[model samples]
Target: MINDGLTDSKFDQRDGIPDAQKMSRAPTVAIIDIGSNSIKLLVARSSPNNSGIEVLYTHTIETRISSGISQAHPRLSAQAIEAGTRTVTELLRLARAYQPDAVRIVATSAVRDARNGQEFTELIETQTHYRVDILDGPEEARLIARGLATDPELSTLNDYLQIDLGGGSLEVILLQKAQIQQAISLQLGAVRLSEQFLLDREAPIDQNTASAIQTHVRKTLETSIDGSLPSLPVVATGGAIVITRAILAAEDGLTIENRSACMTMQEISQLRQRIGGVPLHDRLAIPALPPARADILPTALLTIEAVLEVANADQLTHSFHNLRYGIAAELLEKR
Candidate 1:
């Protein structure tokens, strides 16, 4: 059992890796990530050895399809169902247009949490001849860990904790010697939590709301982690953390790599508070943050803060890589 409580833990910034000068070619791989908040399709060309996949094209559709699907008596709303179907159709069309050698589609937290998850999978297979693999949280965390290790930005870090916060789930993986030791996926996510708790904020981040979210996340992670909350270097991924990092960079006049840069707890707390106070319209105006994210960012911030607290990390590193690259890497290795 990995420790999930926030500790004043720290990790080294292991940047300055020599670029791959040989420019090895990448294979063409297509992947569709059915997340709770959105569906993304990525088509990339990669190297023969599965070392890299150069992104060729991408498509994203904000479905909110998994909204409210994690509650005690949850069901996929009609709107969510239609939106998912349409999103998959669009992605399949794009895949056909790209004519890639193989297309791999994986549904993350949202679909996995939905009672009608298989129904959605069947729909995809029937309509697009594509089988959607619903990855368990631990597998999701493992693949994300692999992708992070491959990133040249953090090339020197030997022991690291990687966190990927998605719409329907949050995946945490502990890595040592560039290998994964423990991985778990908690049932807390931006969109899922937002639909349930943060869709409408009745007040600011007082002790009450913060305590509530913290307790809920702590309990959920405790269950997922078993018993122990180990101390390790921390790395973070997913849209919320990425956006939070970007916003921090913009405000602090700091220039760090989008996903590989380190972030201070002060910064994380500040962002969480600032976003929680801002009106939805103003949040939408934030550059790089889409309108789709405005509603859920508050919950996202809370979730991040909770995870950071449980992990006992005073600072964290953020990354743009997630299910898309994970799927690509898995396919390349399998091939």
Candidate 2:
């Protein structure tokens, strides 16, 4: 099992009171995550004793703001900027419904990597009247690790690996004995890889192209990952992994809620093969697979499988908590 770093004593000492008694004292907060592929909103409140978080609402909109992000002079297109701004406005409106004590809007790899990223953020700020905090890779990884700590199921884990694959970047965090040893971010995201390697996303990917993508991922990991990773359980989060788990669970005639969190390397490889062999349309027809992810899922799986190989991990446990959760947790702490 993976270690989450949070211990029972830590929780006990956080507030030293019953959660029920502290409920009214907790603060509600909203976090909007603007990513490469989508924009998401999360509204949550701290537990009465401030030892936990209670999710109030969540929503996602596919804006694909990172379109053409792999270009030589990467910039957000006019259409992408407009769509992203509209989505952010909509999500912000939804978040305001809860009258949160604080609201944080953050942008990730896509906005940070794009040459015209600041333009997009400026437009959002101009229209939405909210400051957008652009998170660097390390900060993003740190928040993701903090978010994973909120999961009670993983609270006992003291050492493990965490990987969060987004549309524009991949975040890898290594922790031993509850301390982070390394946090690395790479430009190995599914959308980036797809735009760079897969020229014909609408058609079935050829064997050569598939191999090429895998090779690129492996080579990137080989060079980017500094040293040999310890033999520890891997916990994966992010849209790609969540969608992969949903698709796999649906294939087995099980609901996402009832499916096992543990996914073997073989399962990931098999799914990649099955999805890659089909065209985008066929992948879209698969139950539980998001339409927005249909075109990039194959590449996402390739990257995920590569990560497992590099880590020498046989399986990974999926976590629902991620960056947004971490942001909310921090907001509550400040209150």
TM-score of each: 0.83, 0.91
- lDDT by residue for model 2 over 1-335, one digit each (tens)? 21111212122234456666544545678889999988999989887566789999999898788878788778998999999999998987787666566778899999999898899888887876677889999999999999999988899998999999999999999988878899999999989999999888999988899889889988887888778888899999989998889988999999987999999999999998999899898888899888988999899998999889888999999998999999989877877
| Tens-place lDDT digits, model 1, residues 45-75 | 6654545666678878877787676587566
Per-residue error for 49 in candidate 2, Å, reads 3.7
Off by over 4 Å in 2: 1-25
Return the top candidate by lDDT.
2
lDDT per prediction?
Answer: 0.71, 0.86
Model 1: residues with Cα > 4 Å off, grouped in runs: 1-26, 48-50, 195-199, 202-205, 226-228, 252-260
